[model samples]
Target: MTHEEKRAWIRLIVAVIAYTAYVVVILRRAEGGPLPDVPYAAALLWTIGGAIAAAILAEIGMAIVNPRASRVIDVRDKEIGRFGDYTGQAFVAIGAVAAMLMAVAEWDRFWIANVIYLFFVLSAILGDVTKIILYRRSVPTW
Candidate 1:
């Protein structure tokens, strides 16, 4: 796989793992009782931070493991990136719209914030998945 492909795999794996961990923690915290208010801000922040740190660490580890892998960014890479970005951007817009509606509806801040965070994570995962798929297949012509 290319360096970019590896990065996509790393992002997809890391995002899923980190998000799963966050969800598990929240679920565990709510066990044996009513779904208590989730401490969403700190949890979301930490999960985002941890996902970033983990991705960086994974990339570093991959570099060390394959010291001779060419980390080159070529035309195909750029094309795949652009395609993925465009594919994933819709989720961000949806998230923003959802948050705005929630605000107008006077939903709790926690719900609004978590919805935004969920959409962002969805965006990243979907983007990376798109990149991976494009890498596997030929880029479609317009």
Candidate 2:
């Protein structure tokens, strides 16, 4: 696999795993109480930080495991990246709108924060998936 593809895989895996861990932690804490009442800020922050650390570490490990792996970035790579970013940004916009609406409706901070976090994770996963797919197949030209 190419270096970029490996990076994409790392991102996808890390995002999913981090989000899942956060959900599990939050749910466990909510077993006997309201979800909003659960202590989620620490868990959310930790998971986000952990995901970033894990992805960086994984990339470093990959480089160590295959020192000869090509790290070249071609025009196709750039195009595929742009495509993935554009594809993923939709979720971010949606999340922002949702959060704004929630805030206007006077929803709990927990719900608004979680929605934003969820969309961020989804954006990463979708972007990574798109990059991987384009790498495996072809990137459409405009």
Candidate 3:
């Protein structure tokens, strides 16, 4: 696999891990388990802080392991990123509209939020997969 492909995989893995952690947290909260008796505000703050820290550390580690591989993305890379972003955004917009309609039709529920989140995650995965397929099929610009 190319360096870019490796990087994409790393990002995907990181996203999956983060989302899995989020799911676990939500499940725990729903189960009414004691979570150190921290205030909701404090928990939210800590989760955000931890996510940021984890992202920073992952980036640093990826760069350290692939210094030359990670530096300066080329034009094709930028194009792929743009395409993926646009695709993901389109999915999010569609998901939001569907969620709104569902809320009106069926009443708001936790499952609606979970469905939206799942849509977002699936969009991201599909976008990355599409980019990789394109890259593999097309000739390299460089």
TM-scores of all candidate predictions against the true structure = 0.95, 0.98, 0.65
Q: Sorted on TM-score, highest at the top, how do the candidates line up?
A: 2, 1, 3
Residues 1-142 of candidate 1 have per-residue lDDT tens digits of 9999999999999989998998887788867654437566677789989999999999999999999999889999999999998988999999999999999999888778878888988999999999999999978888
Candidate 1 global TM-score: 0.95
Those runs of model 1 whose alpha carbons end farther than 4 Å from true positions after fitting are: 32-36
**Per-residue lDDT of model 2, residues 27-61, tens digit only:** 99899788989988999999999999999999999
- Candidate 1 worst ten-residue window by lDDT: 32-41
Superposed by TM-score, candidate 2 places the C-alpha of residue 66 at a distance from the truth, in angstroms, of 0.6
Better of 1 and 3 by TM-score: 1
Candidate 2 wrongly placed segments (more than 4 Å): none
What lDDT is obtained when candidate 3 is compared to the true structure? 0.66
Question: Candidate 2, 84: how far from true, in Å?
Answer: 0.5
Clashes of each: 0, 0, 0
Task: Tell me which of candidates 2 and 3 scores higher on lDDT.
Answer: 2
What is the C-alpha lDDT profile of model 3 across 1-142, one tens digit per residue? 5666665665566557666776677667657854433234444445546655776687778778777774567887787777766766777887888788878888545556656776776677777776777677863354
Quote the lDDT for 115 in model 1: 84
Each candidate: RMSD to true structure?
1.2, 0.7, 5.2
Estimate the lDDT of model 2: 0.94
